[model samples]
Target chain A: MTFGETLAEAWGPLREDAIQTDAYLEMLLAGATAGAAPTGDLPTVEGTALIDPALVGAARALRDALVRIHPSFRFEERLAGRLRAAVDGVALPRAAGDPIPFRSRPTDAAPGPIPGDVVAVGRLSVLAPSLPEPLDRLPRPVLIGGAIASGVSLAGVALVAWRRRPGRH
Target chain B: MPVFGRMRRGAPADRIAVYDTDRAAVRAAGRDPRQFEALYRKYLPQVYSFAFYELGNHHDAEDVTERTFLSALAALPRFEERGDGPSTFRVWLFRIARNAISNHRRSLARRREAPAELADALPAPLDPEHLAAERESVARAWAAVARLPADRRRALILRFVEEMSTAEIARVMERSEGAVRVLVHRALRTVARELGARREGDARQRR
Candidate 1:
C-alpha cells in the first residue's frame, strides 16, 4: 500500500492509542495517590507536578512523527532532547560499547551477529537481582556464630562475679 | 555481570540527570504511591511510545505499557539509583517492552498490519522540500525498513522511531551499543540504497 494509505490506516489506531495512554497514566496517578495519604511521610514534593497534559501532548507528537517518518532519518539526538524536556530530569542513553552486529534468530527468517546491546543488558539482568533486596537473605552464618561466641563470654563473666562474691567466699 | 567497581566516566550527562530524577521519584514511590504517581505521569509518554513503536499493535502496545509501569511500581521499593548518568529507567522500561513484544512475537508471529483508516487523510508523496527543511530524508526510506529482517527492524524502530541512543538501544536490544549502532547504520544505508534503486527504476520507466 502507499505510504499515505499506510499512515491513514495507522492514524486512527495511533490516536486511539494516545487517548488510551492518557487514561492509563491517569489511572496510575490515581492509584499511586490513593495509596499515599495526604499527610504521609514521603520526601519533599518538589518536581512531581511536572507530568502535565503538556508533557503528554509532546509525547504524542513524538510518537506520531516516529510512525510517520522514514527509517533512514535518524531522530535519536532530537528525540532524546525532546524526551529529556518532557520528563524533566530523565535522560535516556544509547549503547556505547563495541558493535556485536545483528544476528537473526535461527527459528525465523528475520535476517549476523546478535546486537551486543541486547546481550549486555540481558547479562546485567541475569547478574543483577530483579528484586532490590539481596538474595543474601539468610543471616550471615559467621556473624551468627560470632554473636553466640559473644553471648558465651558474657555468661562466663557473670558466673565468675557470682563465685567471687565476699559473702559466698 | 561486569561490575565496574566505580561508575564509568564520560557517560551521557542526560543519563546522570535521569538517574538523579528517577532516584528521587523511586524514593518517593517507596515512601508514597502518590509521589510515585508523579513519576508515572512523567515517564508514561516515553514508556508508552517506546512500547508502541516496538510492538506495532495498539492493543499489545498498551498492554505492555501498562505492564511496564505496574511492574515498575511493584518493584519500586528496592530500586536503587545507581546514578549511572542516564535514566536507566527508560532503558529498563523499554527492556520490559522489548520482552513483552518478543514474547508475543514468539507466541503469535506478530506481523505488521497496514496502518489503520485514520491515516487515510494523510497527504501522499512526502514533500522532499519539507523533509529537507527538517533535515529529514525521503519517505521512501520506510519501505526499506518494512523490508528489513525482523531483528534489524526492531533495532531500527528503537533507534529511529523511539530515538534511543546506542547504549539505550543496547539495553533494550540486550546487546552492546556498538552492535546497535552498527545495525542502525547498516539499516540506514540499506534503506537509502533501496530508495535510490527505486528512483533509478522510476527514471528508467520514464526514459
Candidate 2:
C-alpha cells in the first residue's frame, strides 16, 4: 500500500456511510411525501447543488480522489454489516405482525391511567359504544374494579343477615 | 461590479440555473410530496456525507440523515424565507446530525458496549514503509480521538471534519463559542501528541 492507498483506506468507511445516508434520505422523503418514489438512481453530483455548490464539488472531489488513490478500499462490506448490527443494537421499529414474546395479563395490564398506586374512586363513565374500539375498550379497568366492589357488597349483606337471625343455636 | 460582472456572465452557470430551478420547484411543491422528493434527489448525497462523517458509523448516520430530511420536510410548512435560506437549511440539517451522534454515543455508553468502533476494522497493512508509517499516524489519530473525553471528541470532529463554524458548533454542542474553541484546542493537542508518539516509534524502527 502506498501513502495514497493508506489515505484512501482511511477514508474507505466514509463512502458506505454516504451511500446508506442517501438511501435512508430517499426512503424518509418518500415516506414524508406519501407518493414520491425513488427513481432507483443514487443521488448524483447534479443534485448536490442543494448544498453550497463549491462545498459539494469539493466533497465529490475528495471522495473520488480517495477512491482512486486507494482502489483497494474494501471496507464497504464490513461497514454495512456493522451498520446493520448497530441498528439491531438500537432496535428498529418492528413490524406489527412480528411475534411478541409476551402478552399483558388482565390484572397486570389494568394499571389505572399513567401507571402507579394512585387509586381512582368515583362513578365510572363508560364511553359510548359508537366510540372507537380503543376508546371503548378503555375504562374496563374501572369496570373490573366495579365488579369486585359489587361482589364484596353482596358478601357483606349475607354476613349481616346471618348475624341478625334469632334462630342461631 | 463592472470588471467581475464583465468577466463572468451576468447570468449564472447551467448548474446554478438547474439548482435554482429545482429549488423553485421544491418550494412550489410546498406541501406536495413530489416536491420534497425532488429536494431529496437534489441533495441526498451531500446530507448523507455530512451525517456519515459526524456519526462515524453508517447506521446512525443513515438514521440521522433520514430523520433530518424528514424533519425538514415536516417543518417545511413553517420554513420561513430568509436571505441565506439555503445556508440556514444546511446548518439545520447538520445540527440534527450532531444531536443524533451525541444521542447515539450516549445510548451506546448506557449499553456498556464499545460505541461500535468508528474506525474501519480491517487489519492495517504492513508491506511498504511509508504506508506503514502513515497508517500508524492515522490509527493513532483515530485512537486518540476515540479515547478523548466525550466533550473533546465532539468538539474535534465538529471543528475539523465537519468544518462547522464556532458559532454553529456552539449551537450544536450547546456550549459557548469560547468553550467550543477551548475544547477543540485541547483535542488537537491530544491528537498531535499521539501522532508524534507514533512517528517516533516509526523512526526508531527505521534505525
Candidate 3:
C-alpha cells in the first residue's frame, strides 16, 4: 500500500476484526518501534517503508488545525460558573438522612362550618339565624310589608319589558 | 466465544464498564443536580471544543455551549439510560448541542448576519511572525472544511476532533456504523485532496 494509504488506514477507526489480524499487529509493532519520529519523517519499519513525507506532513497539518481551535480557560471558567449558579438556583432534593422537624397543631384551628338555617334571600343562599317561628307565624305587619315590596319589583320589571317589546311602536 | 469473535461482537469489556460508569453518573446527575457538576466538568472541554469548531466563533460557541448544558440539565430528569453504554449520554449531550447550533445558525440566517470567519475564531500563536505566515494556510484548510456538507463536516469533526470511535460516532449521529465509516473516509479523502491542491497552487506561485 502507498504511504498515504497506510497512514490513513492506521489513523482511521480500528475495527474490532482488524485488530487481531497479522497486518494490524505488524502495523502496531511498526508504529511502536517508530515512536518519537518527527511528524513527517518515515520510520524504519522492518519491511519496505513506502513512506511519503509530504502526505505525512499534510496529515499532521490537518491534525494540528483540528487541535488549534479550543475553548479558552476564561471561557471554561465563565461557563462553569454559570452552570454552578443554575444548579444552585434549583431547589434540589437534599441528600438522604436529614432529620425532620416536629410541629404541633394549633388548638384553635379554623372554625367549623356555621350551624343555621339556609334561607334563599333573592338570588343568594345565605346561612342566617333560624327563625323562632314558621313563615305563617311571622308578624302580620312585616309579612305584609315584604309582600308589597316583592310585588312592586315584579311590576317594575314587567313594565320595562312591555315598554321595550319589538311590536310596541 | 473466541477472543476475536468477542472483539468483533461488541466493545471491549473495559470500555463497556466505562460507559456503564458514565450512565450511572448521568442517572445520579438526574436525581441530584449536585451530581451534575462532575459530568459538566468532565465534558465541558469536549463539548466546548465541538461547539467552537462547529460554529467557528467563540461568541456562538459560548452561546450554544450554555444553551446545551442548560437544556441538558432541564432534560436530565427525563434522560433514560438505554444500556447503549456511556455513548448514550455523550450522544444525548451532542444531540442537544447539535440542535442548539442549528437554531443559532437559523437565527443568524434570519437576521442575515454572516458567521465570523474560522480564521478569526482560531487563537493567535505566541510567535507573531509565525502566526502571520501560517494564518492563510490555516484559513484555507478551515474554509475547505466549511464547504463540506453539514453531516459530512460533523462526522469529520466528531471523528478527528473528538477522537471518537466509529461505534461511538454512529451512536451520536444515529447512523449505522458502516455508514459512519464511509462518511469519515470520504471526509478525510476530501480534506486530503483540498490540501494537496492548495500545496500545488502555493508551489506554483512560489516558482
Which candidate wins on TM-score? 3
Query: Which lDDT tens digits does candidate 2 get at residues A39-142?
Result: 23334443333433333322222221111011111222222222222222322212232221111235755544332111223532221111111111212122
Best by lDDT: 3
lDDT of 3 by residue, A67-95 (tens): 53556655554455344435544221121
Which ranges of candidate 2 are over 4 A from the true structure? Answer: A1-169, B1-31, B38-56, B80-87, B109-116, B121-130, B201-207
Ranking by DockQ: 3, 1, 2
lDDT tens per residue, model 2, B1-207: 001001122111211222233446444435333344455544555556555544555565566665566555545444433433233444555666666666766776453222344446324677766567545444455565666777877665554444455666676666775566556545555655655666678889999
DockQ top scorer: 3
Ranking by lDDT: 3, 1, 2
**CAPRI accuracy category, model 1:** incorrect
User: In model 1, which regions exceed 4 Å deviation?
Assistant: A1-169, B1-19, B81-87, B113-139
TM-score (chain A only) for the predictions, listed in order: 0.19, 0.24, 0.25
Give the CA lDDT, 0 to 100, for residue A30 in model 2: 38
User: Cα deviation of A77 in candidate 2 (Å)?
Assistant: 17
**Interface RMSD (C-alpha) of each candidate?**
17.8, 19.6, 14.2
lDDT of each: 0.46, 0.44, 0.58
